[model samples]
Target: MRFLVITLIVHRPDPVTGITPSARDRLREVVDSAVLAEELGFDGFGVGERHERPFISSSPPVVLSHLAARTSRIRLFTAVTTLSLLDPVRAYEDYATLDNLSDGRLELIIGKGNGTAQRELFNVTPEDQWDRNAESYELFRQIWRQDTITAQPRYRPALHEAEVWPRPYQQPIRVWHGSATSRESVDLAARYGDPLFSANVTNPIEPYAELVHYYRQRWAEYGHDPALAAVGAGTAGFHVAPRSQDAVAAYAPVFAGQLAFQRSMGMEPVFPTLEDFIERSSALIGSPQQIIDKVHRYHEQFGHSVLHLHAEAGGLPPAEHRASLELFQSEVAPALRRTIPDPPWPWAPVLPEAAVTAAAD
Candidate 1:
């Protein structure tokens, strides 16, 4: 399986000390984390986009572009680009440039983002969100594939034989549809034969599993090859120590802090306690063996080939956070890599040509 480390760049206070980093410090941490992910041999590193409070990830393209300059080999991803609130033309322009800058290492996970705050900022109603997501994606696909495109979309201004500059370094960049409690996203992914990425963080496995099942059913119904159906899943949290008991002890406070934050936001958590969250949700808080077992269990249900773990510890100390990631790399990843097979993607970007060209330039 392909493994990824993702961060939402949430700017929250340290749970133990109640100290929050400055915006610049937070962004620097994100960059440092991406660098660490590559050094530790992660397949990809993702940055989330959230145009709201307590999040410094409102501009993923800019952040990812900076990462592109500092790292090589590790693919850069937008965890879920909020397509519903964006103009496809502008989004295409920025990502196309990023694709070139990253030497075709850009992969997008698109979704109609949640939360009423962003929707209000974009002047999008709840009723039109799905439609906006679908429409924007269709147009975005056209912009990447065709050189000259003439089109009219209900949500965005018309494109009349317009040419978007900086053609993607990869002919057709890979796009994974992000699904979170929505069949519309699943249907859209199935209809286009694109991959589906389940946001398996908020709820239990049942809901996300049902959606994956639905996606597969639709993929078959749409006459796409079953072998080509690619699915990715996300974990709520992660912390692996030498012993399971030690991991539990270390992460308990982090979990309590997270719950407190959720409660403050008036959001009821599905997993009430830390133990419950570890048992029921995708939080991999235990020894490496336990994490592997949990992944195998979920893989049986979702048939996912790609898995993403949180890069940031909710409120753990930097030393503990780094140690967890180190443990994952040294212990957990090797086992999982051997056990699980990677999905068959149509193509991967050829970096040699782009690298040579940039050097010459």
Candidate 2:
């Protein structure tokens, strides 16, 4: 299985210690984590976008551009770029520039995004967000494929064979649709034969598994190859130690912090207690063997070849968090990598000889 480390750049005070890093420090941590992920040999590192309070990931392109400069070979990803709230033309321009800056190592995961504050901030409503997402993606894909395209869209001004500057470095970059119990996103992903990435952090396996199955079903209906349908899944959290008890004990405060943060936000959590959270949620907190077993269980349901772990050092101490990640690479990853089949990585384009000559001339 291919593994990615992702962070949403949540800027909240530590629930356990009542300490919050300065915004600058918080962002520095994210950059540092991406570097660490590369050092630890992760396949990719992703940053999420959220235009709301407590989340400073409003500009993933800027953040990813920096990450691209810091590391080579590790694929850079947007955990879920908020297409519904963005102008497709602008979005494509930023990512295209980033793709060039990253040496064509950029991949995208697009979603409508959530949260009332962010939706309000972007002037996107639940009723029309899906339509906006679909429309934006249609235009965005056209921009990526064609040199110039004429088009009209409801959410943005019409394009009359408009050519966006700094053409893509990659002929076509891979885009994964991010879904969370949303058939609109799933159907869109299947219709286009793009990969589906399940936001599996919230609830149990049943909902996510059902969505994955439906994505596969739709993939067949759309005349796409069943073998080409790729899926990736996200985890609620990640912490591992030599012993299950030790891992659980260390993660308990983190769990408590999560519940506190939820309640503080006036949202009730599905798992009120740490034990329930571990029992049902996708959080990987246990010994290495137990973590591997849990992943196998999840893989049986989702058939996802890609898995993402949280990159930030949430409530855990920096030393322990680093140790857990190191241990995972040393132990858990090898075992899972041996058994789980991975989806094909995105193709990096090679310029034609004619194009190379034209550029030189």
**Per-residue accuracy of model 2 over 110-200 as CA lDDT, tens digit each:** 9999999999988888899999999999999999989999997898999997999789887778899999977999999999999999999
RMSD of 2: 2.3
Which consecutive 10 residues in model 2 have the weakest lDDT in total? 346-355
Q: How much is 48 displaced in model 2, in angstroms?
A: 0.2
Candidate 2 TM-score to native:
0.96
**Backbone clash numbers for all candidates listed:** 0, 0
Checking candidate 1 for backbone clashes, the offending pairs are: none
lDDT of model number 1: 0.92
Instruction: Give lDDT per model, in order.
Output: 0.92, 0.92
Candidate 1 local lDDT, 200-257, one digit each (tens): 9988899999999999999999999999999999999999999999999999988888
Where's the lowest-lDDT run of ten residues in candidate 1? 346-355
Off by over 4 Å in 2: 345-361
How many clashes (backbone atoms < 3 Å, residues ≥3 apart in a chain or on different chains) does model 2 have? 0
